[model samples]
Target: MKQIVARGALAGLLAGVVAALVSVLIVERPMRAALVIEDARPAAPGARGGDLFSRPTQVVGGMVAAVVVAVLIGIVFAVVYRWVAERVHRQSAFARSLHLAAVGFAAIVLLPMVKYPGNPPGVGDPDTVDQRTNMYLSLIAAGLVLAVLAHWAYRALAKRNWPGPMRGVVAAGGAIVLAGVALAVWPANPDPIPPDVPAALLWQWRLASLFELAALWAALGVGFGLLVDSSARRWAAGQRAAVAPT
Candidate 1:
């Protein structure tokens, strides 16, 4: 069925591409520059993890690796999105798809730039900085495109009133993202810099970068109308009523 496909394969692919792209363009580049490697050489002994920081044998290797990771992360997101979107609001397949994409773009692409401190030339290159900034803008545009189009499509699918408990999920999603952004933009020094990280400063920057990832999906709930405004309005009314007591 269409729902099955959306919940499984299609969702996975979308999440993978967005997550990987965001990781590469925004997170990966900044982390790379921060490391200050003199040469783009192969990893040596003690470079064990083969993480994002690992120097690639070929461009293809890096690309493939990124895609694989993106896909895996995307699959997880697909399930989560479907559960919440369906249970809370009964958003259609297309709407959920767009919402996932937007969330990925915002979290991966936009949030990084918002959260991180600029690393100037001595600290980092202008080209790298510019690329990261441009990438963020592109992701934001992509998210808006997804949101608008999906919203249009969503008009046709089943929709729910969204219960009181569900609104908590939406608010939580927003808070998580905001927290991640705050950490990356102003990261604390991580205890042990991962080996691929060439320097101490790079390690610190990456520490901040990793934490910001939490917000990627969280932002989606806020932007995509996953929350229940009714409760908020009611609470405000209650406050006013209490204040008007004789």
Candidate 2:
């Protein structure tokens, strides 16, 4: 168990580094270009850039933050894998890791994003920032809870000898229905973009943000699988050596 944890942590760190690179090279570069266009748009006499840091500083800081977030997420993936390994039937580590990653992406990214899509800087109203933040957080919390309930429902049904397809259908359908209800109850975020802002820039920035997340999750899944596979192979080799007559 200790070895597994250590390996998982190492895998997560490496994966995080890769993810950070992807964000910096692929996502941030394009996003910065889009932001420049946004900044060039005319502003009122008293207007100023609504940034805490200069563009270069923001880019470097964002890369660092991405790496840190990826590392933490990797550790979480390790812990989750450990917990699920014992409870679930034996399966290839890659398959299990991928499955977990898919569920995680759905719960953490896809669902919340559907309700509160990402926006570029200067795209939200300052007056309602607090409200928007709270609403987004609530959506994330609700999505996570629904994901857990769906998992539980699937397990419960499986234990009762329910058909596998039927169990999956019920679990998935229930979660979707619950999520729909939540979405209906939640207040929509008001559009904050002024008439002069370019819609193309906003769209590009939002798409880049989503791409960054997709890259991070993909790295986590693939990296975890490779680590687990390598570890298993080494363990098997050691076992074989121990049994061999010297």
Candidate 3:
């Protein structure tokens, strides 16, 4: 039990650091570029650059904050992985991890719409509507993709010993369904006019962020799963060694 917990925590911490770095590289950088272009093109731009890129110092600070948050999140995820591995029935740790991740992704997609702050709603009268819808649509697509990928991964791992076409079908099906649902449910956002930033951009960034998170979740799941499995195998080997005697 202690070994599993320790492994999970270590894996989670590693995943968090990697994930934060990936987000900074892939999502933040591009978002910054988009913001810069948008700000430069504006007829009368506000003091705040429309992009995260305009402020390099701020961006770095944001990245640091993100890294810290990711680390904490990683630890929590690790603990959950250990608990689930120990208590789950029938399904392997991999399967449980993937399924839980899918659920987490889905919740993230729905967050802007259903959560406390509500959606961005753009800068319109209905401050919640446009932002909320835009966020939902963008995240839903990404969330579905993540779900499918994770599910297929789980299926593949669960049935690792299986042979031939059966395994292929199972894996493919899992991936497809996981991605399809979220995309289908996503709602589109209206383009923001001059002086007003487009909701689509916000949604796009959010969507990309979700993908970054999905990658982290996948890594953590795989890493923690392998660790737990390895620990169990080692323990079994030790028991065999003891019973056989010197």
Q: Best candidate per TM-score, number?
A: 2
User: What tens digits encode model 2's per-residue C-alpha lDDT throughout 14-91?
Assistant: 767776777777777557766776687778688774887887898788778877777778887888888877766746
lDDT of each: 0.47, 0.79, 0.58
Per-residue lDDT of 60 in model 1: 45
Total backbone collisions, model 2: 0
Cα displacement (angstroms), candidate 3, residue 107, comes to 2.8
lDDT tens per residue, model 3, 118-150: 222233334556675666666655654564465
User: Model 1, range 133-179, lDDT digits (tens) per residue?
Assistant: 66455544544454334344333232455553455355445545544
lDDT: worst 10-residue window of model 3: 114-123
Q: CA lDDT of 195 in candidate 3?
A: 51
- How big is the positional error of residue 73 in model 3, measured in Å on the Cα after superposition? 1.9
lDDT of 2: 0.79
